[model samples]
Target: MALKYSNKINKIRTFALSLIFIGIAIMYVGIFFKQSMIVMSLLMIIGCLATLSSAAVYAWIGLLSTKAVQVTCPNCSKVTKMLGRVDACMYCREPLTLDPNLEGKEFNENYNRKKQPVNKEN
Candidate 1:
């Protein structure tokens, strides 16, 4: 089985976008309990928080994006921003790497991790 990879920046942006819709859905549901002022208010508050959190996420990603390195993808020949040592091309989803040692090696997200998991053998 092959694992599909997506650009980290795009993935975070998608999550933030979904949060907005989820917040709107929550607020819409609050309309059903109009009779209960407390319930309605609580739902509205939670919904607003969700929406605000998404904004924060957007801002954070924006900051990270500014720091990301820009590179032209070999497969797509289009410019894209990438974080860490390994990431997929935003436009083509082609695996990319900065380290010469990792070139031609199988793409693994673990390359970005600070610590490698111990392999236990019996």
Candidate 2:
């Protein structure tokens, strides 16, 4: 499949981690603006907001984890959590789907999008 996919939880975790790093970097930049009280304060506020947002994201992930389906990956035989109709194995990166109709089909993120029924007039 041309589509590149990764575990949903893993992806969100990565984002949360990156947000933390970004927050630290932003705060560090604030140090350079020490001569300007307004600029430094602004930078610090932005950094704090970034860090706080990451914490919220992490909390949201915890909530999602509770709802995710736990399944054993056949390819790796490892237990993994899936978020939607299809997701990749957390350990082995094996693609998995809860829907049988999607089995062996090309992996597409668009499959997750809601499809509208087409109207036909005879």
Candidate 3:
């Protein structure tokens, strides 16, 4: 089976944006429960929590952005950030690798895992 790939940072940022929209939708629905003050208040609180969580996720993304390696994507000729040994370009979804040995190989998330050292003396 072929694997579908997307930039990790883009995927996470999309999720965070979705959370904000969902939180707004939930809060809008709370208006329909105007008869019960308690229920409406509870829904509002939940919505607020969702929005706040999205903000936290955005902040975490900022931290990750700092650690990710920035490179110019050959596919799009645009700069993008990569989190691991293998990652997709943010704009063009082109597979990329930091290791020369893995260049041109099939894209695999396993490449991101730490490799066991081989004994060169053997």
Candidate 4:
């Protein structure tokens, strides 16, 4: 079966969530090395860094969300946020686009990177 893509924000949120879990797991594993203070400290530090990085990712997503266009998904009839010229519905995974030229065409992520009259420099 082919893989399904999720909304960019949702994907990033999932990643951050996973990182929190991974950090906790690493800290738990460190308990096994109680005899080695240096190893235990290193493991704890790594775990803390993972969680801190996850927090940063969450903050970044929040900033991106402000720039995302809010639209009602026709497929699901629900309000959702889109990040670029094209995106998928967060609820139904239905493809959506803001460009009139792209309507009725196959959804391609490259459409976001395609050169256009408007400048959207990062």
lDDT of 1 by residue, 22-102 (tens): 999999999888999999989998899999999999999999999999999999899999998899999889999999988
Off by over 4 Å in 2: 1-4, 116-122
In order of appearance, the predictions have TM-scores of: 0.92, 0.90, 0.82, 0.86
Model 2 lDDT at residue 90: 91
Best by TM-score: 1
Candidate 4 per-residue lDDT, tens place, 63-122, comes to: 999999999999789999999888888998888899998899667777888574453663
- Candidate 2, residues 81-122, lDDT tens digits: the string is 998888898988888899898899767656666782343652
The lDDT per prediction is: 0.92, 0.89, 0.90, 0.88
What is the lDDT, from 0 to 100, of the residue 83 in candidate 1? 96
Q: Write the per-residue lDDT of candidate 3 for residues 1-122, one digit (tens) a residue.
A: 54658999989999999999999888998999999999899889989989999999999999999999999998889999999889999877889988898898778877787984454775
Worst 10 contiguous positions by lDDT, candidate 1: 113-122
Could you say which candidate leads in lDDT? 1
Q: What does each candidate score in C-alpha RMSD?
A: 2.2, 3.3, 4.4, 5.1
Error of 4 at 107 (Å): 1.7
Model 3, residue 101: what's the lDDT?
86
The residue pairs that clash in candidate 3, if any, are none
RMSD of 1: 2.2
